[model samples]
Target chain A: MDVKAEIIAILKDVTGLDDVGSDPAENLFADGVLDSMATVEVLVAMQDKFGIQVPVSEFDRNQWNTVNKMVDRVGELEEA
Target chain B: MHNITPYSSPTYFIYLLLLLSPIMIGLYNGKRFRVYETFATVIILITAFFGGNMSQGISLICYILFEMVLVLSYLRYRTKENSKNNFWVFFWSVILAIIPLVFVKIDPLLNNATISLFAFMGISYLTFKSVEMIMEIRDGAIKEVKPWEFIRFLLFFPTITSGPIDRFRRFQKDVLKVPSREEYVALLKTGTNRLMLGLLYKFIIGYIFGTLLLPKVSVLALSYQHQAPLGLSWWVLAYMYVYSMYLFFDFAGYSLFAVAISNFLGVKTPMNFNKPFKSHNIKDFWNRWHMTLSFWFRDFIYMRLMFFMMKKKLVKNRVTMANLGYLTLFLIMGFWHGETWFYIVYGLFHAGAMITNDAWLRFKKRHKKSIPSNKFTECFAIFLTFNVVCFSFLIFSGFLNTLWFS
Candidate 1:
């Protein structure tokens, strides 16, 4: 799978919601799809899978609140 | 050489406005008078600290110097090419950053007196900013730490004493640029509105509730303590609600003044309150109340600790991990408030509330179909949350300690 698809898969697995990635711009936090614990789990999974370190300080909720945003952030991190 | 506490009185506001007029004019014409702004800030600081508060002024200066060295050194280490980002260095930097605050917090316990050599107004809030910078630097999020910008961010006179705890990046963004005339006009409108609201909240409503009602209710609560179980009476309940309102209005009022003056200075300081009593749950209450401090705690302490634990697989169960996180966060918060039994109990009480709230949420989710959901339920949830929060404030107020111990 592509990076985007991989991230969406991770989100689904972490949140236990099959339709988590249905909307690319859905707010995972506001919609209650991802709580603090699930968000941490997703971050951990991403680090393990993609080898990108996202420090808690650098994690802006608004910037990473959606599947599309998460994929884009991951891409940016990969490039850096 | 007159002493003036920031946002303390009408006279202070008048003096502040007079000082800010030139800055406001500069911003209106799409310019930042950096030198004049610094001059005005120095004058304000001198008035705030140099007169009756001379000792605090000295302490603040020493503390700032200590933090600047620590932070700049850390930033240098972090920014070096191929730096290892040593954990011990970062760890020690944070510890050193918080040591003054620790001394101030613990001095009361050691001496049975509130005063401490390290104690100064806004020490806790200043420590928050310094520690935040260090953390972000370690994360490689902060690439540069200019000395002037660092000091200005820490000593931004309006919110220096008690912050809405503006982030370094956010504050830098506004401080580095002068807003357009239209933006400045909008900011001025909002600032004026906030100033008026602050007057109402602090002088009028807060005065009525806190100065007028609180003392009378306190006396009543104490007098009626013998007639009720565990010294809990209608009067005590009255005192709790009154005290809660007083706390909210007074602090929120002060926060408003801070934010308003920040806007006038062309910086968009984050707000601290958001109608907290309207919250439907304990977690929601935290998000709405003392928002900046809570967000700071959430970002720096709670989130970081939780992430570390989950990453290391330190705690196997997610629920247990969250509970532990809440416990640590609130306990530290309690201790941060002061070294008092009531403060500690207040922290533990909130932790328990949060854990129980989590359990109820999970159970409700499981039984979503059976659990009735409607307008009444929502209102009931808000009412229940309000009472729970008021009770927490009662614990925080230390009136119980006075009743039982004193």
Candidate 2:
């Protein structure tokens, strides 16, 4: 799977929502697909899947609220 | 000399309504009288602090100054490009923020010397807000801090004592805007409704359940427990239900008043309870009950711990990491209630429930086809969750210890 698809899968699995929708720009937190707990699961899944580590201390939901933003964060972490 | 706890009785609302009338009129006219609002806030604070609570009044003043310096200093450090270790700054700031609260909560357990001098009502709520702001600063969620605005947020008196703990950013947004007339109208209607409901819940219903019924059932329950083997009987169950009702009505009623007052002031403070007894599981129960506090825990304690565990590779299994997070989150919460065996066990009991709830949910997901899906099952889930919660409340009430040991 591509990075976007992989990210969506992680969110879907964590939220237990089959239709998380396909808008990468949509706010996952705002749209109610993910809450604080689901967000943790998504971060864990990202780490387990892509070896990308986003430290919780550094995690701000506003910066990483959208799927696109999360993908961007993951990419940045990977590069760092 | 009006000795009043905030919203504790009918008289407080009368005083509150009189004080807030000018602000409400100003808001209805699409203007926020900042000076008047601040004056009213000061009046309420004075009434809360100095109205026969002289020591706590002094403590509140000292605590505010202490936190003001600590937060402003931390904010200054945060803005520096080449600052001291960010971690230690964050660590010390949080510890200092909570030090007064620690003294307040732990003082009762010591019995030797009363550190009540360091104590004031609403210290815990203020500490939660202060620590949250520091963490937000660390994450750059709060990029800038104004000292006066920060003080206003901390001392926002509506939900001061027991909060549906408001966020700094959210509160700041509302504080900076004067809601439109239409919006104020809606807020007035809803606010009145909420306040009336709160009055009904806290005064009437809570009186009936907590004041009237609790003592009777508690007496009977203890008497029966003394005679019964294993100190358990139907009277114990009766105590559990009655105490649960009392707890819900009393606290939820206070939360409603807090939210209602905030709404009247045009802040749209978040709701604290939402049909919590109808929750289908333990996790759902937390989402619905004392929502602000639980969400605070989820964001600050539980999620952070889960991420830390995953990042450090402390546990290989993701589920175990989540479970451990629940335990830590709840144990800390339990400890926060006070230094007591019942409270600790209450926290552990909820942690166990949440873990089992998680496992059951995962299992149900896997066995969806075999599991029945109907109103009966749904009702059964609600019933089970309710009983489990009531049982936890029984532990929390400290009645069990009194019954068995005392």
Candidate 3:
């Protein structure tokens, strides 16, 4: 599966919202795509899918803040 | 006999100062007079020595440590903005909060159910605040802190006893601002109003209703003269509903008082209740009643556990089987309430009620569109859901003994 697609699917499931309309660059938490705990849920779900252990430190408010940033994080971890 | 009443406070003078000093700190923060905010917290904590119990002392210490850990880490990583520290903080903070709860709270409740000498004045609030702070810190949302800032943050005594569960970022901004005399006086009146209303709820509503109406209803139910009256069950059940509302009013009223008191002293406290009796359904009720406490459970327990279950495919058959996913969520809720069977049952009962309510709503929305919306239908559902919640409280009352299966 494409990593971005996988990420998007996980976000969808975690939120239980079928259509989240935020831009990929918009912060998931602040933009309300994911709430505080849902953010953790999505992070954990991403890790399970890709078999990567994203640390809690990766939950920074910015940088890995949006979908695209979170995708980049997955890429960094998978490559590592 | 020398008379004593609610107006009397053994620690009134010190608490007054403890409450007042925060104003100066808020004043200083507003004046840009202080370099660090945590110092105010330390001074207030020094004042907290006059508090009633050891549990309170431990809670005070732990809250500050957890706050410091998060604040220091946030300050360290705020600029560089990598998430490794954020990850560690969240991971560690969750563990830090849960370990104490498991060992100190749950274990004892299961074993002896002793309400410890320390029953910790504000354990519930502190746990929520500490965990939320760690998450906020990891997000780099908190910009600055000094020791005094932390004291003001944690030990602002009004919200210390009962809480509106103020969010840190929102609370921090409010703490930094100074209230004018008018605003301050208005806050005092508001606090007084809440406090007075709370007394009415607690003494008049929760207390009098508990004694006069609730127990009488219970006794009648238990001691059937010839046969258990069919209507007697409804009476006991109805009064239970009223008592439960009174209980929330009592607690939420106290929370509002604390919020108002904090506001009067120039601190912002969030609104805790939204007319819970008006909640039409279980989810809505939880969202309305003891709201901060419920939200704490949602953010800390439910969402994380649900995510984990979904990841493992444990919840895959959940809707179909009604077996695992939501049950686990409820069990967590139960355990979060305490270690007794009552709490567990209470948790599961709520889960079952809420799921049923949700399914029913979806069915109604889908099928009953043709039926005109009526106050009767709306009020009937609210009536039913209220009865369900009150019935669940009965399970909690016996939580320690009969929670498992009885």
Task: Indicate the DockQ of the complex predicted as candidate 3.
Answer: 0.13
lDDT of 3 by residue, B1-406 (tens): 2211111232443465464565555553444334333454344444454344445567557656755665555556654645466456568656765455555565474657653433455566666776676665554455566765665566656666557676666677776666665666666667667666755766566666666766675556455423544334444555556557656756765666566556555666767887877877787787678777776666545655655565666645534323343566678778867776678888888878866865665466456657667899889878887777778876676621321233
Candidate 2, residue B184: Cα displacement in angstroms equals: 1.0
| lDDT tens per residue, model 1, B247-286 | 9999999999999999999899999999999998998889
Off by over 4 Å in 3: A1-80, B1-59, B70-89, B107-119, B143-147, B180-189, B211-239, B300-329, B399-406
The residue pairs in collision within model 2 are none
Stretches of model 2 off by over 4 angstroms after superposition: A1-3, A12-38, A44-80, B83-85
- C-alpha RMSD by candidate, in order: 1.7, 3.4, 7.6
DockQ of each: 0.74, 0.38, 0.13
Q: Per-residue lDDT tens digits of candidate 2, residues A1-80?
A: 88888998888777676767478888876555675666777877888899976656567678998888887888888888
RMSD of 1: 1.7
Give per-residue lDDT, candidate 1, residue B365.
64
| lDDT (Cα, 0-100) at B191 in candidate 2 | 88
Answer with 1 or 3, whichever has the higher lDDT.
1
